[model samples]
Target: MKKIVFLFAFGLAALFAQAQSPAKIGFADVEYIFSQMPEAKQIETELQTLQTQLKKQYDGKVAEFQKKLQEYQAYGNTVPDAVRQNTERELQQLQQNIQKLEQDSQENLQRKQVQLMEPVYTKVGKAIEEVAKANAFTMILTNQVSGLDVVLYADDQSDISDLVLKKMGITPQAATTNPPKK
Candidate 1:
């Protein structure tokens, strides 16, 4: 009975010790880190170029649509029934094509954004992991820059965002080092 009691007390003491140790928690602003990265600028330029091309395509289609519409209106009354019907169908098809292009362009832009950012995200993720491990942080939460409410409040000392930027070889901006006020 004494031996069992001793084992129970030993276990309780161990539990108490473990419970007393505070977890090292830190926060990183991934968005800030990503913004400071050169890859982000490249991605933005590429996306802009793609957006410009898509816009040009959209503008051309609208011009074509407008031209057809004007032509139909100009000679619509003089044209035969069959020609009028065909022109109307063509105009309808062109409208559908324009709408389809708008949708496709939006989707394409989103896909391109994700594709371009995938590598950046991976690189940042690796840097965050390294920083957390090196700093002895048990858990790192996303800073308030993210729309998530995971972290309600965090001390300035607990912010490792600058460390993460340094890990990625980017100099963090001075403003970013300072945590925002509540």
Candidate 2:
């Protein structure tokens, strides 16, 4: 009958649709993985040392500038016009040097951080890829809790962060309870 045929067709369509749906989606927190890495602590220590050294140098420059500024303020009015103008030029140059040094230090710190973290990031990325391929994950989303939320909602079972860590030969901590489901 026409009704039977139509019902059969509809059932076949539904089954096909279900077959075509994505198999799995996973979430990972790369920052969390980095926090667990031993090398990360070492990198932090190195960066801190560099920062401290830079700060000391910066402080010395600042002290020098302050000393010069004080001298100018105290003796500026008593000095000859040409001497005052030359001191002003020197002060301006010192200020410019201080600003340049601060900028360079910041840039150097950033560069060093990237250089140190690059290998760790690559290792984590490869582990994530391996886990995704082995588990047949259709997509693996980063779940970093920066200012913006990367993932709105994911089932606890769909988190692949532990698996990636395990792939990297790191034992994961006990799983935490999932957030309340909506």
Q: Per-residue lDDT of 89-166 in model 2, one digit per residue for the tens?
A: 998999999999999999999999999999999999999999999998988988655635677787878878888888
lDDT at position 89, candidate 2: 95
Candidate 1: C-alpha RMSD to true structure equals: 2.8
Model 1 alpha-carbon drift over 4 Å, by segment:
1-16, 145-152, 176-179
> What value of lDDT does candidate 1 attain over all alpha carbons?
0.88
Model 2, which residues run further than 4 Å from truth? 1-21, 174-182
lDDT of 2 at 95: 93
For residues 26-136, could you state the per-residue lDDT of candidate 1 as single tens digits? 888777787788798899999999999999999999999999999999995898999999999999999999999999999999999999999898999999999999989
Q: How accurate is candidate 2 locally (lDDT)?
A: 0.85
- Scanning candidate 2 in windows of ten residues, the lowest lDDT window is 173-182
